[model samples]
Target: MKLRVFNIIKNTKVEGPGNRYCIWVQGCSRHCRGCQAVHTWSHKGGELYDVEVILDDIFNQKDKIEGVTFLGGEPFEQAEALGIIAQKVKEKGLSVLCFTGGKLEELRENQINKKLLDNTDLLIDGKFIEKLTDYSRPWCGSSNQRYHFLTDRYNEEIFTKYKNKVEVNISKNGQIFMNGMGNFDEILRKVDLMGIK
Candidate 1:
């Protein structure tokens, strides 16, 4: 199968745990306002590439990367192609992560999307809300999104246990700042009082 993708980053530290290979697939419809990757929202925006070819490149980096991340253009839209890549990544014993605007409930209704979900180890889901931007949320652009650890392991749980929010800020001057959930003093206080840590 062939998939349209905007770009491929061989190594990324922010998208997921450790270092990850991030694939930005092409096409999206839920054009959220203030989307960071606005260039990726159009359906006809990216280059076409064969799934096997992309897999070959990923395999080349298997030695150094911890896992692979599937970002949009709504990865669920390319479910068929992603399922193929996810299968190979599983064979390598590498963790799999996905970012999507579609809710997990809706994804479960489609067989193809379900396959993509089955192969994913971690999922960050829901549309990005600009008004909800908090520099202290983990792996999500907005506070309304969620991170699910689909697999048996507790990696994401541990991550959230330490800090549930992941904050990121980028300035026009090209400066970047990222902090974990604990940095939000009010949230930390709630977590402590509620014994939710």
Candidate 2:
């Protein structure tokens, strides 16, 4: 299976409970207004990477990471490919966290989506609602989004700790990227004013 990858962050503390390798899969069907990642909304964009190769990359740095996180375009949109990768990651004893625009019940109705959910330890679900923008929940873009803990690996307290916190990274080439749950428009505007990107 090959996944259409929009971006990858090798290490990040704000993605989950600990340092994590984050994969932002390409393409999103739901183009919610005020979405920060408008660049990732196209289904035809991004490069195709084999699932095994991605797994190898994660395994190579397994010791430095507590788990892997799948963000989007919509991780569930590429359910089959991600499910395979998630399964392999779990085999290596790393936790899996997936963020999806689809609701849990909607995803559960599909066999492939169900497999992806089954492989995930935690799921942050629902479309990002601009009107419901929330700054108090970790790993969730909106108040309407819910965190579903499929396994006992993480607790509510862990989620609360990282809420409203943003992690900003500047690449070697000086491109800027931001992650975490909150209204980041103002902060990003400041970054733009500083001419960082």
TM-score of 1: 0.79
Per-residue lDDT tens digits of candidate 1, residues 71-127? 977899899889989988988888898999989988998887866888898888988
What is the Cα-based lDDT of residue 101 in candidate 1?
92
Tell me which residue pairs clash in candidate 2.
none
Tens-digit lDDT string for candidate 2 (15-104)? 887899999999998998888788898999999999989999999999999999999898888999999988899989999999988889
Instruction: List the candidates' TM-scores in order.
Output: 0.79, 0.93
Which one is best on lDDT? Answer: 2
Give the residue spans of candidate 1 off by over 4 A.
154-197
